[model samples]
Target: MLAFDISGSMLKIANDFLSTKASCNILLYQGDCTQLFPLRSNSLEGILSISVIQWLSEDSQIESFFKECYRCLQMNSTAVFQFYPNSPEHADQFVTVANTTGFHSYLIMDMPHKTPQ
Candidate 1:
């Protein structure tokens, strides 16, 4: 497994935690998710991000990030990102960008009762 974070401190904390409990060989790196990842095209089976995508404040950055994800993932693979959009328009932007980047996107609201802030 490969994991990365923009924060060196976060990576260190993850490394310290994973070293004791993780069963698999997990490689960790410190890098910006909005930039190109140190990976080859069509190399990854899947990608998962938790509360990360919303940090990209610009449309180009989001588009670039999605494009990079699409480039790295294998055909028919999925990249699931869990994030809280600031508003409905923000959520729509994510879906729109994902679709524009050649991904068949879906938005699954975990809590339908509570509206997005």
Candidate 2:
């Protein structure tokens, strides 16, 4: 497994926490999500992002990020991201960009009672 973050300090904290557990298969690295990932094309089975995509403030950056994700993932693979959008429009923008980047995108709301803002 591979994990990356733009913050080295965050990676250090993660590394420290992982060290307390049994042997882990995860490889931690410092990387920017908006830039090219340090991985070969179609090399990854899937990717996961937790509260990360919200940081991409520009459409170009989002497009680049999605493009890289699509390039890295194998055919029929998935990339799941959990993010808090500032508004409904922001969330829609993400899905639109992902779809434009050739991904069959879907938006799932965990809280059905609350409307997405």
Candidate 3:
């Protein structure tokens, strides 16, 4: 699982995921998640980033990160991602980046409040 932002709730989710599932491997990193991806591995089956996309501060970087996410994933792979669509405009941009990334994705709602900057 590729958890972006590393926030408190996200950290709790990560901890739970780790404790409950011992069959998979997990790695942790600090900082922007978009730059943290594009991992080289044919073994990677999928990725996850919950309530993290909205924290993206730069539009260009988010787009680049989407590209990286596409590259890191293998064929038939998936990324269960989510984020708060604070405004219609912000939502549009996020959707645009994900759509243009050349990866199969879906818009998941029920996102929490925005992270404090």
Q: Identify the superior model by lDDT, candidate 2 or candidate 3.
A: 2
* Model 3 lDDT tens row, 37-111: 536844468777666677786988888778777777888888776667778778778878888878655655553
Query: Could you give me the TM-score of model 2 versus the true structure?
Result: 0.92
> What's the true lDDT of residue 70 in model 1?
96
Error (Å) of candidate 1 at residue 97 is 0.5
TM-score of 1: 0.92
Winner by lDDT: 2
Ranking by lDDT: 2, 1, 3
Candidate models: Cα lDDT each: 0.90, 0.91, 0.70
* Candidate 1 residue-wise lDDT at 3: 87
> What are the models' TM-scores?
0.92, 0.92, 0.66
Off by over 4 Å in 1: 112-117
Q: Per-residue lDDT tens digits of candidate 1, residues 45-99?
A: 9999888898999999999999999999999888998999988889999999999
Regions of model 3 farther than 4 Å from truth: 1-25, 36-38, 41-43, 111-117
| Residues 1-117, model 2: lDDT tens digits | 987899999999999999998989899999888999888999999989898889999999999999999999999998998998888889999999999999999999776356678
